[model samples]
Target: MLILPILLAFQTAEGSGYKTNDFALLGSDGKKYTVKTLTKGKPVFLVNLYDMEGSQGIADLNRLSQMTMGKVRVVGLTTLSTRGRGLARVKELGVRFLVLGSDDPYSILDIVPRLVIKEAGSVSYLSNTLLLPDRRLTHVWEGYNRWTLKRMSQDALKYGHVRLKIDFSRFPEKLQRGYGEFYGLGPG
Candidate 1:
């Protein structure tokens, strides 16, 4: 009996479709910004990672930031309070993109490390939802894969008016191999 309500809550908590609620967050630069302001009529790649120390999440964000530089607006959102070491980690990571503080009033923290794309002022795609159990990644939904990255790049080109071409040759050998394995391009 109790399980039914729990399941219902979980279902409603997921932001799978379009989002209407605008986010107002403090950026790592100590400035408050809204989603629309940051996007500025561009396609946005929004990464939501609650745990600052998630290695995979950090690596993926770093790669995306480098790949989409000057093409798409890459923003990192975190629900964790950036009151202490959280702030330090943001600087230490040397993140080239804006890392904003997310105040999730809707309780969708479970479906985080998510990739949300916005085009022309509305959410066009949401993927890579991970649900963690006891700080351990238990579920991964179509995220950190080559297909998704390719699709995101395509969308940015189609909607954001991005003209920068993706030069995979610039990526490190390790990343190239990782992408190959994820997209089945090179020897697996």
Candidate 2:
């Protein structure tokens, strides 16, 4: 009976109280940004570019940016395997938010285990669709689906304290999988 509940626990969206850590990472603009710096009094949305493909999730972030009207900070963190692709896609789409390329993937090392543990319901705060308005985790999601975007929109509304005209028509219908946000490889 206990085993059944344990498995079912991870099948739904779980709550989070995970606190974020600070680390400086090199951005595509050739600048260094830390969680503290990006979040500074604004909600920071961390979107992971798992494959660095031209996923609709990028555009989804853009739309959320527009909806928030600059009230939130959305940063895209692509996997090391697909490093540099985020900046390109952001530039290609003329994205409003900052999409980063890693100069040092080690910056994420401290946080990955926490996220993984959280998603497994062993701890808290998983998913690349993360909301870190402060050091405390606001929310984390497992997939970049329409429902998640809607949740983000709700977040925007709460943070922005403004009425939003949301239109999900252009958003992608397919659900995108989450990546581990892992980076940097060492050779023995």
Which segments of candidate 1 are over 4 A away from where they belong?
Answer: 1-17, 102-141, 168-188
Model 1 Cα shift for residue 70 (angstroms): 2.3
Per-residue CA lDDT of candidate 1, range 47-105, in tens? 55444555345655676677767666666666554545656778777666777764552
Models 1 onward score TM values of 0.58, 0.64
User: lDDT, candidate 1, residue 95?
Assistant: 67
lDDT, candidate 1, equals: 0.47
Give the per-residue lDDT of model 2 (tens digit) for 109-154. 3554444344223322224544555566545665566666677667
**lDDT scores in order:** 0.47, 0.55
